[model samples]
Structure formats: C-alpha cells, structure tokens
Target: MENNNNLNNSEKKGIGRRDLIKGLAAVPVLGALAFSTSKKNAYDQNLKNSILRELNIDASTPPPTGPMAGDPVRLGIIGYGIRGKQLVKAAGFMARSEKEKLQKSALENPNDTRLKDFMEQENLNVRFTGVCDLFDVRAEEALDTVTTDDNKPKRFGTYQEMLASPDIDGVIIATPDHWHAPISIDAARAGKHVYVEKCMTHKVNETYELYDAVKTSGIVFQVGHQHRQTQSFVTARDVLRKNVLGHVSLVQACTNRNSDNGAWQYNIHEKASPETIDWQQFLGNAPQIPFNKEHFFRWRKWWEYGSGLAGDLLTHDYDRINCLFRMGIPKSATASGGIYTHKDGRDVPDVYHVVMEYPDFQMGTSQEKGKEKGFTFMYSATLGNQFGGRNTLLMGHDATLELLGNTITVHADPRSTRYKEMIKDKMIDPEVPLYSYNPMANGVDGVTSATAKYFANKGLLFTYRNGKRVDSTHLHIREWLSGIRNGTKVSCGIEEGFEEAISAHMTTLAFKLGRKIEWDADAKKIINVTEEEINQCDFITI
Candidate 1:
C-alpha cells in the first residue's frame, strides 16, 4: 500500500525529465537529454528533508517547540550599520499571519503608515542583548532602536567584549568585509552562534580559517545569503531537478543599478570622526591610515575594506544560482572590467565581468552520461547602467530559466528534443514563456512607499509563500534561531558560505591580478599562483 502511494505521488508529479528520457528512449534526439535515475531519487530525498525546510514547508524536523518555545535566543549585533539595523528590525518582525492583519488595518486606516512598522514582539523568538560598533554613534543609534521588555541594548566598546559576555548566545557580524573573518573566527572560538553578513571573508586564506573555526566550534553559523529562503528559488530548484530546462550549459547574471547609494556613496553620518569612531579597530588588518569619513561610510569603494563588485554584488547573484544548483567552487576563474564610472578614489572596479569554469561539476552542466566537458558561469556588473534590469539566466539545451527579482520564467528552446512533442502540438511557444512562477499576485503594491520599492528591487529583499508576502530576512533569522535550538543546519551555513566565499574570492583575485585563476580542488589552493602573485593584488596586502 505504501509502495502504491509512493508510485501515485510520483505519477501525480507528472512527466519529469527522467520520464521524458524513458518515454523517448527509442528516439536518438533524446539520448543527450537522458540523466541517471539515481539523480532523481537523490533530488527527491534531499528535497523532502532539506529544501522543504528551507522553503518553510512541512519537513520531518519539527520546529522548536515545547521547552524551546518562547525561550528567546539572545542575539548580539556586532555592526550597527545599514545591514545591522535591518537585521535587528527583522528580528522583531511579525509572522505572515499577523502581517495580514496589519495589511488589512492599513486598508481601513489609509493614513496610518505606522501599521507597517508594527511588530508582534511577543511572538519574536530572538532578542537583541548587546550592540557593538567601532563607530560609537552608530552603536548607540542601533541600541536606541532595539527594545525588548522596555529594555535598551547595552553598548559594547568592541566586538571582543560583546563576544566575551555570557549574555550573548549568538553574534550577528555586519562589519566591513575585512572584519568578517576575524570576528567570525573569534565568535566561533568563544562558542557563540554566528550570523555573518556576506562576501563571507576578505581573502581566500581567511575563508578557510573561518570555515575551520565554525566547523570545530559546534555552533550554528548562517551566512547572510537570505535568498536561500526565497520561495521562487526553491521552486526553481524543483524545476531544475525535473530537468525541464535540460542540461544547463551556461549561466548569465547581472547587477545593474545606476544610483549614488547603489555605487556605495552612502550618506556619511555627521558624527563620524576620530573622536566618535574607533578608527584603529576598523582598520585592524588593513594598512594604517588616518580616519577618512568617506572610507568610514562608503567602505565598499576600497579594496582594503571590501570585495567591491565581486564580493558586494556578485556574491548576491552567484549565491542565488548556487542555492538553486548547489554548484560549489568553480575549477577556474578569469575576470575583467575596471573602475569606469564611480571614480571617487576607489581602488576596486565599478564595473566587472567574471567567467568561472566548472570542469568536474556535472549536476548543472552539459555533461551527458560519462562525458566531462563542464559549463561556464558568467557574471557581469555595472554601477553606471541600469539599462537591463538585474537578473539571472540559466541557459539549457531545452529551455532557459530566467529569474528577475520576484519572477521566474522558463522559455523553451526551439532546438529542444525534450520539448518537441509540446512544440509540435502547439503547446509550447518559442517567444512566450512556457512556464512562469510569479509569487506576487497583487500587481503593484498600493501601500508600499518609494523607498520600499528601491530596497525591494535589490536581491531577495522580499518573497512570498502561499500567495502571502513574507520577509526573507525575517524567515532567515528565524531559521537561524530555530537551527540553534533544534540542531538543524541553516540555509546558508558554513558549507554554503564556504562555496560563496571561495567563488567570490576567485573572481576578486583574478580581476585584481589581471590573470586567470584555477582552483586546485585536491590541494585546495589556486593553481599556478604564488604568494608573490597573491601579494601583488591590492586587496591581499596581508
């Protein structure tokens, strides 16, 4: 009976890639499209256990309940900058069910914008215990905003002090890129769970160090690639697993936003100065320099402080694809482009392009059966142009999967043998999308302000579940907190974070050196590169 039920479920799922292969076994055209039956079973097993949990769907692992219920996880925030404040606010966000009430209230009282800011604090499973920042004003500002039990967050002079405090169960590290590895390593060593913002680390060596620390510490660690929680991505993964797009040969991703803030010209706080900031602490591993307000506010502009395009923007784009296709570090990477637009004394590129080679990886590649010619993952970013909106495309022989913010479109290729029957029957079109998943059904939001739209336009800012809007950050934070209690791994934990880190570092290193960089999977080092070659890159001053 159980076997019958399993068979019924599989049949109900309908005409997946494996089914197409078996159906078209006599046809020569379908030979290249056939994949191993084991692959489908593996995907099904993983989807049932892991991907479903990531999508906030019913999973075998129960959410923290009983003794764990209402026991708020004590969270310490290490950086009170833009991302820090966002994380703090997300911690206090109301669940989707309550958010529906707030939306209804907004419709009745149109003038009351405060309904949007309403957070059902009692329901929140995490509370801010301490806030730390090298900038005194920013730290205090963050503390003033976070309130639990009519309680204000205590300010810590440094992250080290906050890490030493027994009050903090976990630490959210939102500091500059260079500080990520150092703080995360220390936090892990101190046996504190971590939620580190992305780019993961400054350099390749520190990436390994941070991974090692997190692995040995036995604590929950979540990288800030919150897109892993986005429902469309989970849907896209299922679509990919079905082999609807056939063997994906190439992937193209872009980051295009022609705005001052988008280029990292963030408004410098008036209180920013040597008197109000720990300049030395902020410049820990970087070369010592006098306090510069521009560098303090717009740290993404420099190689000394940030990973520029590769780490700042490409990581977001790359991680989204990585989440869907589980493509680990590439075999080789080569990069181009330079600081063509925003020339505000920035050392890193304003526009960049990177091509990463995945030679051995076959999951998302064109490799058929035993053949082993890998696919290429290409990334392009420009701060000067928003001509083509930010998006990603996975090109396959049968179809192309296009992801544009909250929308996913599967366009069938004219040459596809798998879609031949559908095409001959006029079921599939060459121009129009064969399938589309739009989670947002309410067209343009009536209540959302202009500022909300701007931020939402950025990667994975918002997603939907069961046709109701959900905060990706809120879900991501809750996942981390739940994982801490239930001993379940997070969506973008150490393993996922490691892949993102290495991939970003590979692009950054290749671009900076003006050469091609190859990942030696066996030795875990860049092939044909020396310490001198690495040191020559501006970002690798250490």
Candidate 2:
C-alpha cells in the first residue's frame, strides 16, 4: 500500500522510530546488524527510545470488529455496475469463474496476489440470494458468477421488487448517487438494514428525507465511508485527540486524477441499448432523455446525475477529515472551478476548488484559546495532471500530519507550543517526523491502475486490520450486518451521512450559484438559499 514517497521526503525521517527502536523488522539487514550489536547502535537506539517515551504517542489500532458468526446474513445487491461488483466481492462473495481467473493470474504473475487475498478473506457467513440491476448484462453476469449449488440467487427486475421480497435480510446499494437516497429510504421503510454508497443523496430534499426515514424506521444504516475501518485514520483520530498536532488551522485534501477512467469516462458496454438497459428507471427523477450510453456509463460527468468533484470526489476527502475531528458541516463555503480538462460535453467541472470555513471549530491544544478558534477546509482537484498524487495535509501549530494511503507521518513544527522544549533541547528535530504509522509496510499490496491506486492511497481499496490487510469495504459491510444481527451501532450511520451529504451539497451549490453559501447550524439548514434554488442547477431538462 505504501510507495517510496515516505523515504523520498525532503526531511528523510526514518519510516517509523518504534519500528526501528524495537528492532521489530529484519529486512533492513544493516539496521538489524546494528541492533544485534547494541554497542555500535546504542546512540541511535537510545535516541529513538527517548523520543518515543517523551512523545508518548499511541500508534496502536483499535480492536477488530466483532466476529461474524451465527446464521448467514441473507443479502441482495441493488447495483451491478463498476462499484457494485467491488462491493459484492468485498462482501465475501465472488463468482467461481472470476475466482479462477484471479487464480490463473496469480500463477502467471507471482505479484498478482488478488486471488490469495480473496480466498483468505474470513467468510462473513453471508448469502447473496437476491440480485437486482437495470442492466441485463450485469444482472446475468452476477447470477452466472455468484449462483452455486447451495445458493441460488433470484434476479429482481426493480429495486422496489427486490425490497418487497421477504427472502432478503439486508441490502447493499451501490447505484448512482441520485438513487442512493431513494433506494435506501425505501429499504429502511421496508424494515431492512441498508448500506448505500457516498454522496448519500443527489438533491437537498432527499438528504433530509433519507435521514428521517432511517431514523424513524430504526434501521441500521451505514454510509459507504469505508475508510472509517482504516487503522491509520484511527491513529489520526488518536493523534488529534491527544493534541499531538496542536491547533490545526487549515486542512487540505486533494484529488489529482489524469486518466480517462479516473475522470469517470468509463467504458460503455457494447450490450447497452434501449432493450438491454432500463433507460427510464435509470433516469428516475432526472429529466427524461433519449437513451445515451455515455450518460449511462459516465454519469459522474453530469451534474444531473453526479455532483462531479464536489459530491463524487470531494465527499471522500471531506468524510475522511470529518471522521477524524468529528467536525460537522462548515458555517460557510465558497467554490470556483470549470471543466479546464476533459472538455467532453460534461457539465460537471473537472477542475474544482472548494473552501469551507468552520468559524467556531477548535480541535487544538495548549495555545491561545481564541487564536485557534477557527479552521478552514480546502479541497482542490484537477483531472488533468496528478502531480504528486493524493496526500492529505493537516497543518497545525505543533506538528504537521501527512496522510498518504494507509500511512501517517507527523513532522514537528519548529515553532511548536507543545513540543517547544523538545525542539529547544534538540531532542526532537523539526525536519524529521516525530512519529509515524505504516500498517501497509512490507506487505503483499498492489495498486493496479490509476483509479485503483487513487482509491488505495485514500484507504478505500484496502486497510490493515490487526496487521493483516483486510478489504475495508468487507469490514464495513460486516459492521452493517453486525448492526442487524448483534445490535451493534454502525460507524457511518444516518447522522454522519446527514452531515456528509449537507456539506457536499453546500460545496456543490456554492459552485453552481457562484457565491458563498452560509449554513444556519441552529436552524439545521442553509440560511441564504431556498431548497428550490439549491436544487435548480440541474443540467439536463429533457
């Protein structure tokens, strides 16, 4: 999961001091030899030990989620598109033929460990007995690959039909952003637990409606923020809570994708047509239009379907930070960008920038209280060039925490209030990281493509659990199932979803309206804009 970027940093801090001081690794032969003869490495070892003891930082991961036992949880898949297949695979249910293909791939290329990892995944004891998709090809493929002698899944024509079935215990919804709220809302009303993908809702009303639906129905609802299961995030939360970073005044998260797939120019299936695809159902609340394969596959390019970088991409980075600090929607947001790249008749901007202000927010420690009262979140993205790919930077008074992939490195600030004495004594160098966490180190990790690498770097594709690489999506799905069967609370529940949706909507609205948008936290609504104005920026009318 980690690249050489950590070592190539200008400071050249050790990967992780604890890993070095404890001599926990053997691969670094010279370092191992040094550790073996402490007489030669006493100064290095003592220095690391002194820093570790002085910092007293906790890099340990939280306990693993409860075991998946008891009767298998009956499940249904609502979307069989790009993300749907990944979600299905993460749910510990892969097609036999697909498994064989991965197996053959591993044999051909020793580095291809996808099959090994998939096979080693601890079975969650789940059954995909119901499958629903508007596309005929995708639906049949799901059946063809997933159906076995013991489990014969039914194919439902519509999500409504699938929700009505008594056979399905819960639903995994990976449909388009617009459909997320509608399907999840109905599924909640149907008394089934729901796991829906990001951006939670397409429009303003649905966000509030879906929240009420999940709340009133008392269903275990989980938003698809799989990074909640990432241990580095847990460590980041710990770091912030422990005030290791001091007063964080600015947060920067970026999305730099330079490929067609990364820009959401997905391949249009040859089988897709009026007869093979459910065009009307796909359109749903969007304007009725003639069948277009481009619209169907590259929906992320349209404001009518996807929220572009704001809802589709920004939300991922937003939620990642939001979960760490538990910071809700910002007080105001300003944004400006255009389709500077990939000008392929798409309305959503390929280059986007949104800045959100949290005036009263204070996740800081040991500074002038009023000085660290406010913070700003800036999300900058460009689909043209991915210069120095996704790295989330949290700047603070005492230290700067860099989150790349599933790893974290905290560099001490020279003018730190918390670590001033250490800096003065030359015990902690501001140039090197004070602490580091890398669960993905020396592991059988793979990043196959630009988009996959992007997700992997964002801790979306995979994360380590108890030192073992586990599909974060799988753990997320299992947590949702546990909420249903074991009465456990889900991590990214309706409340979190509400904040994420509203924040993303506000960012998008700021771009669409070309003005700063303010939120009335007490009123729990945007103060300056009406729902109609907020939702009227749709690109497609026909």
Which candidate should be chosen as best, given lDDT against the real structure? 2
Clashing pairs in 1: none
lDDT of 1 by residue, 1-542 (tens): 44433444655555655567677877865453455456777765764444234223211111222223657788898887878877776777333333566688778877534345334322456678898988887776677666646556688898899999998999988999999999999999999999999988888888889989999999989999877777677668877776677788889988777888778888998888899999989888887888899998899999898999899888988888888778788988999998899877898888899998887666532335654345789998888877655558988888898987667788889987676766776656778876677777664343344334434554367665555565677778777887888776588999989989888988887887778888888887778678777665534554
Q: Quote each prediction's TM-score.
A: 0.81, 0.91
> Where does model 1 exceed 4 Å of error?
1-68, 93-122, 150-152, 364-373, 442-459, 536-542
Model 2 segments beyond 4 Å from truth? 1-41, 538-542
TM-score of 2: 0.91
Q: Report each candidate's C-alpha RMSD, comma-separated, in the order given.
A: 14.6, 11.6
The all-Cα superposition gives candidate 1 an RMSD in Å to the true structure of 14.6
Tell how far residue 12 is off in model 2, in angstroms. Answer: 59
**Worst lDDT window (10 residues) for model 1?**
57-66
